[model samples]
Target: MERRLIHVITPGDHYSPRTGSAVPTVVHGLSAHAPAGTEPTVLVARGTYPDRYTSADVVEYLPGTEPGRWDRRLDPLRGALGVRRASSRPWAAALHDQDEWPPSVVVLHNAPQAVPLVDTTRHAVVLYAHNELLRTYSPREAALTLGGVTAVVCVSDFLAERTRRRLPPALRDRVAVVRNGVDGTVFRPGRRDASAPLEVTFVGRTIAAKGPDVLLEAVALMDRDDVHVTIVGSSGFSATDPLTPYERRVRAAAEGLRDRVTIRPFLPREAVADQLATTDVVVVPSVWPEPFALTVLEGMAAGAAVVASRIGGIPEAVADGGTLVPPGDPRALADALQVLADSPDRLAAEQDRARRRAAERPWSVVSAELDALLAARLDGQVTA
Candidate 1:
């Protein structure tokens, strides 16, 4: 049997080696898993940053012509039309033009803003939901679009359940849970220095949903001078949006503890790994239900004693691999940090388990499962 060609559509500025978002990671993993002779193409929204992944084939859809580059805001009224227009350009045109060959599957990675124009091409359409679109959409709009989707791929069981709860009954059956996997090879644990003060790191967007405020508050409660926290990632949504509510709160929380709390813009992927190498513990105190916390998996892979709130897909990802605390509870988070900081023996034992847990979730294993699922869908053995 001939292998199937898979086309991925994402809202993300794709193929950046340094980008650590789940959509990009999934694309990379799928490319690595594609069978020989099976073509996999990614369609990404054009961005200001230059193309970073030279090796991977990409189709950049210039949504609009801003001075510096393409921005989503350019054609806000007809974003889906813009993506469809770009898809017909040289890069993606071949897929549609080739009469002898047609895409076996069309996978959408959170492009709800532009999903209306997605070309199904009589192939299986899978929309990977990384977050709740209903929360952002009006009731009628959510019902129409979400109901029309052929199949829904959720990153976590928690998210699947949540989505189902919100969706109309007719749309619930289309949802399927497919958890995200980590690159163990790159994120594995490194040798720790005993002399260094305990390093606690949080890597993610500086947004309210990420719970940066919760993290800072928890650190303040600890009141331990020896412990250090590093907050990495950008917050200001350009000059127009300015700082987000969560970013403002995080900034305010770090005021007095400026010496202990280090806030910096996003770092490259390798730099993030470098930070993880020296990290004693990684804290993910997300106040919202994270569909899947990729950073938690990264931290576990890097051998940090993971401390995260027991919410969303986090508990599913950690699964006895690391420390779990109640979300939004500063005292509980501080207590967990204090326990890890004060007891090296306990942290070491947990670190071993965390590493082992992370090692079990390799991209190869995940890709195999995805391939089989897609195959089943194509064979008509599975209903959307």
Candidate 2:
């Protein structure tokens, strides 16, 4: 494998070291560690995070009306692009003004606004799909934006299928699935603390789509007092903003289980891994379809039984490794919790299954897969 420059472009910041969001983490993961003879670089328009795992070369922030998703000023763009953050167009144009060598490949993550970059250089563009198509462009816009793209690498098969349907049939040929993976080394197993109470955790944003509310309801429904629940992550997108209304609602919902439930704010990736390591169960109760929840893989890597929503690409990861319940149903979630509670042996079996599944692929393995896809497309082979 000869060395090649790979560039990842995301509309929002790729954070310095703040590692809660899945997209930035994946970008950082790919950028931080490249296979033999490869160089990776990241470009972002806005990010306050300064301690990135990888060296971020692009950090030109632009002014914006508000923080987080649903900025009404760019509401139309969000409806079409499916990203909360604004475009990094200004910095991107400046970067490619051509004093520097253009990347051989450009990965556009969640920003349809930057699709114009395809014309800036001959670099093979990949529109990395991370969510359903509704948040992205319409069929015609998709065809126009992705006209010169080498491929549209989806985070999961569910998203892949949705993406294919979003474009014209001619453009559909470019769609493919490259499932998200976790860092096995950082999320590896730890000794189970049997002395500690049975710890279960729900890690992700506290948004309505994430279904933290359902998890809290399920926790309150569980009759057993031995369970210790921890909900890690805050409600808003900004790292420094006040608690969001959603977070307040979740807190009010968990009022009954105040003593048993611990609402933990978001921690560093290392700390999140530590939390997953000791946790007996990791719940991802997302009501909306998640393209791929990396936390599920991290939990499985840590030898924890994962309980996630059966929607979207989740089944691709949780299959036979843990449990899945219908989305937005607290009763179903409670029932699944009872299953884990009633049978420690069964939970252990699930954990074993998960650990084995997680071991099948590391972040490096996945990055290599992506690199191979890029190589194929760049070589004019379109059978992705």
Candidate 3:
């Protein structure tokens, strides 16, 4: 019997938590929990990493395919064109170098344009949609770019619908929803003391879109000294990355709260989980349409009550486990948080509900679903 091999490809450095994107984290979870019959390996652009093996065996890019120092200048342009970092041609050429035991199926994480780069005739190619990437692609362009893809797996139904709208009618049927997942065991809850102040934590990039500033604004509206808010993230993914004007503004606003607020730099996954474990409420105050936020799942699995903006795929993730406030509305967010802050019983109940809901969609479940999809593709059941 031939062994089924799956190559899970990341759009960026997979080994670093400082990469800031959730694609690497998602790839790690799916590969780590893959079903028994299939073998999964993570393939990524070459980068030196700290010694670790949290995911599947990782393979680096072939020598010539590795981006040169000067190639970094073209990243923005290449990314806008839906091509790979450096350029799509060299990376695509390197993918074909594996003729010995070529992958049975190639899974591209959050890189839609790379779909056509993989030879679908030799290997089944799946594009894992982590955001609204196809919006810029015209129907003709979408058709051309995704022409060779076996299937498109979206992280949420909300994202799936948006993806379908961008693709040509012929390819829309190939889009499927697999919903992003969390590792429940690693993010489990910690003991909380009701006598202490309500602990509110916001974890994500300190960008205007992610709305950490909005969280701070909400905290100001509440004006409760007993509610301690901790903002755990920087302007970007790296702790040493310089602060942007917007982040500086957020810091100034946080300064107004003085002892009530504590702003910290971006932390590793372990640190984030540790913080969430003790947090009473986790806020995802995104002002934009978030495709799907892993923070929501992580917070829920950590047994923290979640209060997020009711936009994009957030409601889908929140379901009945968390509270939703109007996007960019500090008054509404403050009211929502105040309701939980005033009632310890409600907070405890929400935390219980969050953990239970998170348990329903562990990384194991994602692995199982992906196994089914890969099997379908291998069986020639996935239509173009």
Candidate 4:
């Protein structure tokens, strides 16, 4: 049987050094799963150009201008305009022209702006919604785009359920849940120095939803000399924007403990494994309902005992591998931190379980399952 071609469309700003974005991770994982003769093409919206991925069969750059302050203030209006503009670009025209590829399937990764382009093409379309866009987009916009998509694949049951409730009845039945996986090979346990202080790391953008403030507050409450926390990633896009209110609070909370709490810019993806390898524990105190906490998975894969909020898909991701505290509760987060610090044996055992759990959900396994889904869809063997 001739292998079918799969075209992936995404609006994610790729090529960044950050390792936590689910879109790139999913795209990379899916590429690994491409059938023996199948070709997988990834299309990303242009940003500050990304580093080249040698493994990708084809990486197409699409044009999109950055948003201005006014645009930021009026996000919904601007986002709609941006999507409409993006849809008319030459890149989108090129994509539309490629209907000749006789693409077996089209996978959209949160590119509601490109829905019209895909709709014009003659291929089975699956929208992989990573976030609850219904909450972000107007009902009319959601109905026009999401309603027309053939299938919806959500990363977590929470997102699936939430999306289902907002979607038109016709689209609700098409939604499915497919959890993201981690690359276990790169994120395995590392050698730890017993003499080192209990080091904790928080990775991701310094945003309000991530709840960096709660982490700082919890660290401040602990006030332990032996505990160290490192906050990685940029605080704000520009000095004018400053850090978010929550990030500012986090900074303020870490005042006296400043020496122990380190804030650094985003690190390269290749370097993240090494950083996670050395850490004793990783913290993910997100205030919002994260659809799927990819950082938690990466942390667990690195064999660090993960301490995350028990909200959204985080509990599903952590499962029995790590500890969970209620979201936005400094006391609970502090207690979890203290437990890990006080009991090295418990931490080690949790790390062992995390390593085992991560090993079972490797990208190869995830990709194979995706390939099967794509093949089945192409052969008319499966229905939404």
lDDT of each: 0.70, 0.73, 0.80, 0.72
Ranking by TM-score: 3, 2, 4, 1
Tell me the tens digit of each residue's lDDT in model 4 across 1-384.
444444454444563334446676777776766556656666655553467454455545555444456654565664455444333243363355455665455676775555566643466667778887666566556666665566677888889998888766766777787788887766777888877889899988788788887888898889887889988765532223456666666677667686889876666666778889888899999989999888888998987989999998888888888898999999999999999889889888988888887877787777677666556545753222
Cα lDDT for residue 29, candidate 1: 65
User: Candidate 3's error at 313, in angstroms?
Assistant: 0.5
Provide the clash count, candidate 4.
2
- Clash number for each model: 0, 8, 0, 2
Write candidate 3's Cα lDDT for 14-80 as tens digits. Answer: 4555454687778777878877756676666555464435567767764345466677666655655
True-structure lDDT of candidate 1 = 0.70
TM-score of each candidate structure, all chains considered together:
0.81, 0.87, 0.90, 0.85
> Candidate 2: how large is its RMSD?
4.1
Candidate 2: list runs displaced more than 4 Å: 1-3, 55-99, 133-136, 237-240, 380-384
Give the Å error, residue 230, model 1.
1.3
Clashing pairs in 3: none
For candidate 2, the lDDT comes to: 0.73
Candidate 2 displacement at residue 183 in angstroms:
0.4
Clash pairs, candidate 2, are: 3-37, 16-49, 16-51, 16-52, 17-51, 17-52, 80-136, 82-135
lDDT of 2 by residue, 1-384 (tens): 553444554444555555577777777667655666666656555444556665334534452333334443564565366443244344354245323554456667765555665553545567777767435457766666667777788888888887777788889888888888878878978887776667889988878999988988898889678788998887644446688888888888777786778887777788889888888999999998888888889999998988999998998877677788999999999998888777888878888989988887677778888878777767743211
Error of 1 at 330 (Å): 0.8
Find the 10 residues in a row with the least total lDDT in model 2. Answer: 63-72
